[model samples]
Target: MLTITATLRCQGGHEDVLRDALLDVARHVAAHEPDTIGFFVSQDLADPCIFTTYERFADQAAMDRHNTSAALARCFATISPILDGDVVLLTGTELSAKT
Candidate 1:
């Protein structure tokens, strides 16, 4: 299994817009990508500007396909301008899981 975690900080006054865009992306993934096992999005309690996305895929190929998806491109276009800084990505192979 492959896991990808990303952190994005929205520019001032753009938190709601970014959150909506991310939700759209999540919906797209759920509707189009069966290989995507999980997609989770959450906002920071203390800092509304900070958002995190946790994505799990069946394998590297699944992740790669997701990266090249039109849905992801749409998401990038929507979030790029409102982003405060470069996105932070963390990736790894799942070692163990209970779920």
Candidate 2:
């Protein structure tokens, strides 16, 4: 399985907008991407403008597909302008899990 985590900070006064856009992207993926095993978005309690997303896919191909997906492009279209900076991404291979 391929796992990726991203952290982003919203531009001033745009936190809600960023969160909404992320939700839309999650919905689209849930409805259309079979190889995406998990996608989750969350806001940091200590810093509400900070958002983090966790994405899990079947493999590199699945991740590549997601990168090229129109849904993701649409999401970035809405999210980019409101972002404070480039999203931080971390990638890894899953070693073990119970769930």
Candidate 3:
């Protein structure tokens, strides 16, 4: 499995935009991409402006399709202006998991 972790910070007041975009696209991804095994999103309790998304894909091809998907593109366009700085992204091959 291919796993992706993305951490982003919003520009203080744009939390709604970030939240909305992420929520909307997450729904889209869930409904449209079957190969995307898991899609999870979270916000930091201590830091309101910080958020993270964890995604698991079946393989590289599945990840590629997701990266090129239109919903994700739209999400990026919507949130681009509100981003505080460069997003931190990490990728890995899943060694093991409970579920």
Best by TM-score: 3
lDDT of 1 by residue, 1-99 (tens): 899999999988999999998999899989999999999999999999999999999999889999999988998999899999999999998788778
- lDDT assessment of candidate 1: 0.93
**Per-residue lDDT of candidate 3, residues 1-99 (tens digit):** 999999999999999899999998799888999999999999999988999999999999999999899999999999999999999999999999888
Q: Ranking by lDDT, best first?
A: 1, 3, 2
lDDT of 1 at 59: 91
Q: Quote the lDDT for 73 in model 3.
A: 95
Q: What clash pairs does model 1 have? A: none
lDDT of 2: 0.90
Report lDDT (CA) for all predictions.
0.93, 0.90, 0.93
TM-score of 1: 0.95
Sort order, TM-score high to low: 3, 1, 2
* Candidate 2 residue pairs in clash (backbone atoms < 3 Å): none
Residue-pair clashes per candidate: 0, 0, 0
Clashes of 3: 0
Tens digits of lDDT, candidate 2, 1-99: 999899999977998898998899899889999999999999999988999999999999999998899988998998888889889999999777667
TM-score of each: 0.95, 0.94, 0.97
Candidate 3 regions exceeding 4 Å error are: none
